[model samples]
Target: MAFKEGFVWGTATASYQIEGAVHEGGRGESVWDEFCRMKGKITDGDNGDFACDSYHRYSEDVQLMKQIGIKAYRFSISWSRILPNGTGEINMEGVNYYNNLINELIENGIEPYVTLFHWDYPMELQYKGGWLNSESPYWFENYAAICSRLFSDRVKYWVTSNESQCYIGFGYGTGWHAPGLELPINQVVRAWHHNLKGLGLAAKAIRQNAKGEVKVGLVSCGEVGIPASDSEADLQAARNVLFDRERSEDSIDFGFGDLFEPAIKGEYPKSLIPYLPKGWQEDMKDICVPLDYIGINVYIGSIVEACEDKKYRNLKLPVGIGKTSMEWSFKPETLYWVTRFISERYNLPVYITENGMANNDWVSTDGKINDTQREDYMNQYLSALSKSIDDGADVRGYFYWSLLDNFEWAYGYAKRFGLVYVDYSNYSRKLKQSALRYKRIIETNGEILI
Candidate 1:
């Protein structure tokens, strides 16, 4: 089945990942900027100092989106760029850069979906106890207010935060991402609450101030449980793995559920209740803001089987299964099961806000990027998404993970996940075969999936 009418088709990117002018336009430093300077943090010692140079070349990027025939574009804003100190003092130059980018998208017949925070926490905030501070939620509300008041004229879709599980879990729990600090679970739990509270407050603020029917949500990336077979026991096993009471491991799904349950169900999962900080229960009132939709960033799934005592057990992945450049599992059907599970579980409209595979790509000898693997990956995953929608899941939209190849967090420029390949040598972007096929998919409202 084709996607429903008015279903959005677009591409997504993060400010710190794509916009490279870290020092330009009076922008304050971000944790990523500092994290990159620390020895042995990044894979290739690469940073976003000049990532795709999109800060100065967004017009070309927007033109690329227009040419691709997508109806919307989802991109994030750098907190430090708008508020240099992460709290006080507005940087008009930094503000102007985003304004120009937003206006460019609007002028090109494309709608803009703005994500207020995308893991680029201002360095000033990090120094001020970051999310561990009790006042962090209010600080984030202030930031959200500024963004809503400034850009709501054109951006109707507002994402309060993007993938808190990564920014909080990887940054705080395992110390893999920016501001790399392996804090204890207690501290990590504190940071997690702060993010949800901030997102809820931001949603409330955007609803109050945004012009012309704004939709607000949060973005999360986590585990997807796909049943091993089509039996009832297998389906139950998938659910048990996805939503059961196991609390031993600090998995991505745990973080995603802890952060998501409050917003959707007005409480954290039962397994995680013991870990909540004092007064965390009361804070749910602020964290349970009504969201327009839930955005999930899914890349792969884990196979699960029914176990004794009505439990589920994850089976280890066999060796030599297809993998991406990032070594992530290549299970395109993840889109189907995850979407179906989340929509039915949460009873909310779902959006695949980030979905794409990194490929080993470059400009070929004929001056063409013939990335057929990426094109195939997109096709298979999107077809899986369509299957979920066909099964009565309220899957609303799908935003390809990226529009251009840029700095990929700790891996830096080593992993390419964009439909448009960027020549780091000159910062020139060339569209791959995937981009053209994606354009056709969007133009057909995903009837191509049929």
Candidate 2:
């Protein structure tokens, strides 16, 4: 079989990355807003002040997705924009903005998959200890309840948060992301627990407040270990490294289980038990709420081999492997292994919520962006994904990492990862050739890849 019938083919974008009018719409300040102000924090001092101007031009964006035959659009809602302070009055303007965007998508025959949080924490909450505060779960629950009450009538697919590892580990543990703070391991663990609790609570709120049935899940990111060879030992080693609990302590290279175990299994891994806060066991009820699916944002993976001492060791890539403009190694099999591993472990349907590569694209002399490398990347990756399905991996869908070239977090706009190119100076959008290829793939329901 090729891809399963009714497989979702879509594109994704986050709020702060695309929505520009940050200061307007009665929007409150987010940690990212403050993070962008810190000197030397952002590359070339770039920020999201006017990212693609999507705030004023969302209609244009929806049309672009329609032109490319995107059936669904996965986007996030800015928390601070909805509740300026993260826990108080509702901002009608913010609600109206999302309403307009969602209505536009529905009018254009595109499904809307909403992510509640994508690392844009409210500045007011950050000052109050953010996720470290015991009340953070309720804060998120309140926000989620409002969203469900308002938009659930039209939006049915919901993701509570995107990549907790990056937000909690990199943002709090390593000081790499917004509200950057290099806290001790124990504090980081505490923040992670709070984040998980928030996810569970948010899921409950969505169910209780949704106008109708909804599919809820969490988006996680981590390494996917590929076996060095097809040997049984190597396959076991790859699986071991992907789920090992020891990797959780490394902050930057944790495994999916560090977050998924607590959220899905309702208890922290035994290795992490010591670092948990007091009364953490009582929080399991909320953390273990049932989920309809698991969302994973994958890009690259490393090779793993079985070691002599009954362990697995990840091998470093030698010189000359294909690399993206962001320097991420090109590994198409990562999509196969990640889906297979997650499906086998959790027994839940999987969706590749984000997968795409950055390319140093520019308007060529012919006035067209011929992103052939990205096109090839998509073909190879999707081929591997089809192989996984043929081997019994229950993958439900794939959403590309982005739809437009917006703010690239700390890397700024230097890296381009969009199917459609955005001229930074004029905010004009031009579809790369890969987009047309994708349109054909979507039109045929991935038959081209098969």
Candidate 3:
């Protein structure tokens, strides 16, 4: 299949993951920067103090993109790095860093897709309860305003946030990430309310300031959970794969379900409020703002069975598929069904913002990285993706999960997800076998005959 006239082929990365220099150029610390210092938080006592030195190595990375023949690159801006206090003073040096990156991409004939927030919030904001504060909308709007004024001319596409459900729920509610606080069900709803509100306000700000075709949407991780067996327990578990909890008389699912339907349907998933916080109904209107395109981040899939739970009489979710480095399953079909479901239900264009796997890689003695596993993974996933588009899924773009190896959040440098490998010890980058294969696909316009 030849690439469509307007189809996009790109790679993506986040600032915190790639660009180290946490303290350079007046860059204020983020919640993750603080979180990593906590005892027993990150694996193996690792942190991202100097992950890739991409902060100072932006030009080199841009050259790598040029060599890779990537049409566009999606990368995130570090909030704390741009605005030291998370609001007031603009760090000219930090601003110059990202500005140079955008200019470099343009010089190399590559478009820059900017993601505003990518799970790395400023420590100042976290101190004030961050997304928990209703004022977060204004704070985010302020930040958006600054970013637009700075680079809107160069940044053609804008993704407001990475994944609110994961960032907010996992970071604040589940105690898995920075500013980690294990709050109860009620507080989780509050965080969601604030996050959705922040997105709407931030989108409005971006639209007002952007000079390009502004596309705004949050990234969402998707999975089509299937049951391993035909047992009634397994079947029922597959029906409701999300994490549901009954805090009050209201029963709600936290992990995934109905939460995203509102973003596309312009309404909450039918009476999903009693499970939310007080005045949560008022937020429905705010979260229903129209978006140009929605991005789905698909890594792997799941299948589960209803195991005995002390609380819910009947509850089970997709579990145990031999796991990835991130403990995710290897179900590429889930990505296909998920894309189909959203495009059919909402009739909106879908862009796969992030889709790749992390592996413990080793370079063979012949100086070749035998990523046959990744090749198989890519072939199946892209085949399903192409089929979804062929079935009229309104899919527009597909970006690999990352451009270069970088910090893996709490996992530190343990997991590598890049088609191009980065030598963290020396900041030397190499195009892995996967990168070469991807380049060939792009070269032939994705029309390779199998």
Using lDDT, give the best candidate's number.
2
Cα RMSD to native, each candidate? 1.6, 1.4, 3.8
Which scores higher on lDDT, 1 or 3? 1
Tens-digit lDDT track of model 3 for 108-189? 9998889999988999988898888888878998999889888887776888888776787678777888888787766776
Error of 1 at 376 (Å): 0.9
TM-scores, all models, native as reference: 0.96, 0.97, 0.89
Best to worst by TM-score, what's the order?
2, 1, 3
Ordering by lDDT = 2, 1, 3
**Which regions of candidate 1 fall more than 4 Å away from where they truly are?**
249-255
Please give the RMSD of candidate 3 to the true structure.
Answer: 3.8
What are the per-residue Cα lDDT tens digits for candidate 2 across 26-119?
A: 9999999999998988999999999988989999999999999999999999999999999999999999999999999999999999999999
User: Whole-model lDDT, candidate 1?
Assistant: 0.86
lDDT of each: 0.86, 0.90, 0.77
- Once superposed on the true structure, which residue ranges of model 2 sit more than 4 Å away at CA? 248-252, 308-311
Which parts of model 3 have CA positions greater than 4 angstroms off? 226-259, 270-272, 303-323
Colliding residue pairs in candidate 2? none
lDDT of 1 by residue, 210-296 (tens): 766788988877777789999999898786655653565454335456667788789787776666689888888899998888899
